[model samples]
Target chain A: MKDVSRLKSVLEKGGFAVTSECGPPKGADPQAVLRKTELLRGKVDSVNVTDNQTAIVRMSSLAACCLIKKAGLDPVLQMVVRDRNRIALQSDILGASAIGIRNVLCLSGDHQSFGNQPDAVGVFDLDSIQFVQAVRNMRDQGIIVGGEPLSHPPDMFTGAAANPFADPMDFRVVRLAKKINAGADFIQTQCIYNMERFDRWLGIARDRGLTEKAYILGGVTPLKSAGMARYMKTRVSGMDVPDQLIRRMEGVSKDKQREEGISICVETIERLKQTPGIRGVHIMAIEWEEAVGEIAERAGLLPRPVIDDQ
Target chain B: MITAQQKPIDEIRGMLVPYKRILVLGCASCVAECAAGGQKETAMLASTLRMKAKMNNEDVIIQEHTLDRQCVKDFVVTLDDIIGSYDAVLSLGCGAGVQAVAEMFSEIPVIPGLNTEFIGETRAQGLWVENCLGCGDCMLYYFGGVCPLARCSKQLFNGPCGGSVGGKCEINPDVDCAWQKIIDRLSRFGALDRLETIYPPKNWSRKQGGGPRKIIREDQQR
Candidate 1:
């Protein structure tokens, strides 16, 4: 609706937009990003280039997004405040737009302690809300943070992350509202394995009319094995994988676990489609990029609509 | 008050490797309250250092002293008469106290024996929780006396991040989500609406900027 990118047009045209992620390689290997982009090329409407996702060092998100754009896929550049101050962040945002990257997701990334370089200092100069608000100011007012006018502001579709399953669940909806009020045009939430809790969260979101304010994309990651399911349930913070789903994965033989994981993802996508207030699904096939095509096909998201005209 | 904890015995011994004579100095104020760097702690550390040195067949003299407040110049001035006796001053006070002692006795080496933690209160017996960042500004009144800056791992002012689980922080299960406490307290006081007002990006200049901060009162200054 904002004439930002094809993904925006698809969502505006009432199509169930499918998006996925591509974690850039740790080194400067363009082929790795190109290969992942090729796997997700036609299956999803856009791809999110993570900014050192989980605080681990990787190729810069802007560079990866540029590579994705070269491969003919729309890249949603993810920017985290954990590693950069305001000056670097604004410079990168403008640089991303200069390179034809349109969608940008603002996030307060995982703390450095969780990363390999635990001794690294975190520069959380701005929180996620402040980041969203700053980006919106740059886009609409043609100004940088501090009221400094920009010669040509970046025209980008601003997106943010939402976690429906984090603690103090009652306050989650309010936080989402705050994000929307701060000018988040779209929201891609944390991976969804607990549909009931997510549905409940969506109910509150719907009541607050946040669904109308921002396009909500439910996150789904296909579990590769029983071990993966257990890890998601126990180790991943803010994740809500149910015990029943883990048991279902454990009940299957090792050979069938992968297939079961796909089925779970398909079922999740189908349920999310039916759930109110959610406009689309974001598939984070985390190192399992090859399965994205199959998951999208099985989940009935194939033939992604082409809405080039904004 | 400024709270701190003693460095491990092994770590303290490592810093004292080069020195034969040392003064195990302690502070009598905040560190004493937290049971960290007090008169009793100084004596105990002096004894341990002496015993450990003897076991290693090393000759050393460990003197113990406690000041009213090691951060104060007047309290640190008491060391002037007895300065030349020790090779180093192993300050059992907080970082501020250690710096003050180092400044007062410029010629002698000052080694920190305790890690200055934060401005906090003793929650219980042998328990202390950080309650302030000394951000140079105070916003506790707005959040029902619960400080998000010190309590929240992310220092989020709007609300809880998605990483909170069961009222615990994403970083650790032991940490209570600061937003949860703020919301609960605000709800009890019927001041939950205060949270709806979005806080702008913090002015870090006032909190941390330029060189070291200083406050002078004309009335108190001669």
Candidate 2:
């Protein structure tokens, strides 16, 4: 099969790939997306545009990815089942492929209650695993959800999100296996503040041979301050922030907290590099896009690998 | 059984303001079991309304009545003769019962005093948890008898979303993650393999998504 994603090519070539995120603005401003993409340009492999992440309405991910592509960056269009039904999802995948966006990430979006639009009705027409299956079918078999053949099948790489820190911890790897079985080309995990749980989860995956089936990219989010660390621990559901990290952030002087955060992020990246099965790292600076360039450079992930556009 | 909660006292009182005479009607079936509408509740609500009217210096006649099943025409017909005596009826019944009463007496308005909740079971004393959505399709056998359509926050068929923590849903810590319950139950029975196959997107067309539904039994009908 011809490779459609540069990230996939990098990973297949056994290079340590680095990807980052760029959240579209709440309002209709192309410049907002351009500014974020520029900061991440050449600093990462591909940029993922979130689809109303945290349930807050923003510029559509499809539109934002287009902006990112135009800004000379490879874009990964993130699609969440929370907003669109199966028909719309398949349609958007076709559209994303047509618009030169080659990589896509399937996600079961954050619940609407956490977003500004709490009253909005969530449309979970397909779970993330089912979505991965749908994307793979559309790309590989030229089939849509209902098995209808497309005149031209979409050529793209598919990815799915997994959270090792979420509850029922024992079943987390089983869920990852299911995603891989459903045809996930790659897996972007939830942020890894709890290194012990992440390492244990990856070990189980390696034992089960899940690591061989899909490329696993460890997720990292740099905390800017002790307050940010505490908020992630207490307010963010499914996020595991050890008390030691929080105290480490607090251990720094107020003015130097950012530098401490970058150091911690770099340390985490260094640890992920040695982990047996990890293929890459996904840096999600969450609104602080400027921090991603620094984190990638300081962690020695700069000067991204180049591959032929297959 | 269908469950409900009584509407606020102030809202009920406001609706009764236009009427000089009102009958507080209750259903003795599902609503009665849930303690939202019943003979005892009807009397209590009638008394409260009468007291509120007296305190407001309003001349209002409040009467109370309970039927075997407000949703059945057999029980609804008994109110025919005296239906014209009241300006309106405050039906302390589930949504179906309220509509049935309204349909029976088209001349008089039937205002619902209870908000119909969901089809649920009495889990414990003073606790009713919703267990069925009546989606018109049942897949309980595959899930160890747990209905993911009703209990799962996201109605996920493949498995739990990333929001399951400590066996509770991330949306609310008090709510047990339905998939967690399913996995535990299936694991105990050695049926965890059933979840390996991905269930397709639900045919919600068979549900309210299909619009108002109806069932006609020709064998039992005259």
Candidate 3:
């Protein structure tokens, strides 16, 4: 229950934490990550390094986290069950903790069909919720998944992804509750574009007292163009992009759409600040890292709290 | 039941190139039910092979026979009287049936004319969808009689992943998301609370994870 990560400490200290994503380069280039870290260095409390986002092969999240940590930034190592089995997952957790990465995000990643390697075998040996429990068991009980005692257990803050817009709308909150019950210390949701639906899901979550169990971070992504909004609205599964938002983006002049998108993102973050049980905003400016600093500053989330890691 | 599809005529023809006299064998059970290797299909395949060989100026002769169930030794023994006259057996049965036929007549070359697909249910006319993986364990009761291991693309036991959209899986628009079906079925039964408990990682060793599996049912043994 102790705060083992700077992101955890910041939330525990009652500070509105700001986090952003850093997608590792496709090839094995560390400089690409260094460049993103340079843009994100002091603006956010912690950075979440994705594990083969969209199932496209990329630099391992652990290696990327090491690079980010070396660059004087806290890194949340995103671990997905889509690629590795339970043994590899547990092994990586030990490896990550031994190397000083303190935060881990459990995800049942995007289906392989959505990625570059559509034929790749998706190793869902453990779902995201079960993965959260595995990490918790490894950290708290000082044991591996099969019940053997580890020499030194990983003391890391575990997180899981929640998709508020996924189908079977009535069961979304139930799934979120399951994640928390499985020992997810924190949650980062899928990108939110429809505030009405997001607010409705959050209301049900609040009613069930799920908000008090774990730290919830509202996910916000700044659309780069009107076309991207349309693609996300029509093509992206589990994403609920409102048509009105797409119209708003399309209504603006071509040159001003990016600015309009940023304005909308900043407004979403500001609104999230007032929402009950929302401890922070996770800005996923995909390939648009520069926009995160501007979004954070515009939403008055600058000067992120620097908590000394224990 | 176990479902299968007939291998392409070209592939079956290629396998029969060395033989002049062959038996076009079919199973009257699961494969017959799926319309892959039934008596009617066996006769048609025999006629086509004979005509194709004649057209190509090859002296090949084919005889067709459909067994009650090729997987059973009792039915397989019915072919024993005429087995010695044929050079090989082109079995239109499933993988298990073909193997069983091969085992019964140790001397005859058995070429499979069909590829075993999966344990499936006949959804409609000419449509067979896979419904079971034969994971060696069944937990259908927990899932409202729907098997997530067999139907889910990821075989996820806990719940649906984010890829489930509007009841269709993201992998292919044609395939219904198994988890969506499970949720709806459970909801209709008012048993949605069953999903509240987190199921642990499956013991995959019961599956092919432990290598080629076998069940020695001692009670059925003489």
Candidate 4:
């Protein structure tokens, strides 16, 4: 609560924050993280370091966050309960804070079955909501999950994930409220392709007054090709890519698809900015981090607002 | 009831490599109901082991026996007379039943032939599906009798985790999403509002976290 990061400060200052993600390399290569952070530097408010995203084995999120920090960019440490028990999670939170990382994103994580190591054992000791509560307690109450008093509790700006496209759609906002109540200061949602549906979700969220509780950042992933659009539509679960979007990508020439994708992303960002409850956008360009600057510039998110405090 | 399934024949055979005489023990209660470990199953396993031993030209004596319930002391005592003749006892019961037999006869090695699955009910003539996790804390009342801990692959109390598509789980299309079922049941009972409130993380001390749990009723002791 005390050591608010730049992302939290921007949101507090009523600035429309633009956050991007940097995926850690599969091996223990610090340069990979530095490279991605360098690309994301000065273009966005913060960079989210994914925690072995999609359950694949990669550099630990904490290590990557530290590396990103060394690269002179604010790193949002994405922590998933899928890989660690409460002990490890609390310990890592303290370690991350000790290393000057201020932002943390709580998630249940993609199940290990979806990863390369499908046979690996998952430790879902705490769900996303529970994780947020635990982090809040550590930051505010100076206590560990087991009620042990910590001499120096982590001062982190806690965040959680939300998927508007997930099934039992009516309950998505309700779940978001739960995260907010559990002490999520901000929420980065699942990738958005269907703007109309996202608008409807935001309407419900606004009606429920959830936007007041937490900073809502709409998730945007620029499609790379028509094949990527089709794959996202048919293969990915919990993604709501409309038929028209896929058709639009398909209609484009093979060479122009990437440009079309960027336009779509820019348009999505512009529309999301107009949405009632959305305060910012989290652009997940995946491995294509180099294009983030152009996309943000095109979406008019560039000339990033400079917060006075470091 | 606790259900189980037999391990592969090759693995079971490998376990009996050093033993000359073996007893294929079966639990006639839960395992029998699920057609996993029963009197008939014990006989078949004993015959298979004997055939394999003969094919290998190994001198081994195979015996078959089925107890009413291996978890009960009275039923475990039935093996006392003939147990001395066997070098090893291959138990076809749940994990608890196997331990019970091990506790009763400390000298002989107790190898588990069947892998204990879960506390479940027979869904069909031959199919058994998990119904309970014995998490020590039950939330069935809130979930309309469907235990999410047992049904949800993630054991999520506030799920179906975004992977729930249509009505099935993302891990496997055949598995029904526990939350979806809970919602439907709650809606039917005019209690869909129950799901509106978020459930906090489960108190895991009541689960295996507190270590081996026990229940002692002083009133029923005497």
> Which candidate number has the best DockQ?
3
TM-score for all predictions? 0.96, 0.96, 0.94, 0.96
TM-score of chain B of 4: 0.96
Model 3 Cα lDDT, one tens digit per residue, A1-310:
2335789889889888888999999999899999999999779989999999989999999999999988878899999998999999999999999888999999988889889999898888888888999999999999877789999999789999999998878888989999999999899988988888999999999999999999999999999999999999888888888889999999999999999999999999988999999989899999999999999889998877767654
Interface RMSD, all candidates in order, equals 1.1, 1.2, 1.2, 1.4
Return the TM-score for candidate 3, rounded to 2 decimals.
0.94
Model 1 C-alpha lDDT versus the unseen true structure: 0.90
Q: How big an interface RMSD has model 4?
A: 1.4
What TM-score does chain B get in every candidate? 0.96, 0.98, 0.96, 0.96
List ranges where model 3 is wrong by over 4 Å: A1-4, B17-20
Model 1 lDDT tens row, B1-222: 988889999999999999988999999999999988999998999999999998999888989999999999989998998879999999999999999999988899999999989999889998999989888878899989999888988777776888888888888888899988999999899998887767777777767764578888999977
- The candidate with the higher DockQ, 1 or 2, is 2
> lDDT of all predictions, in order shown?
0.90, 0.90, 0.91, 0.89
Better of 2 and 3 by lDDT: 3
Q: Please tell me which model should have the higher DockQ, number 2 or number 4.
A: 2
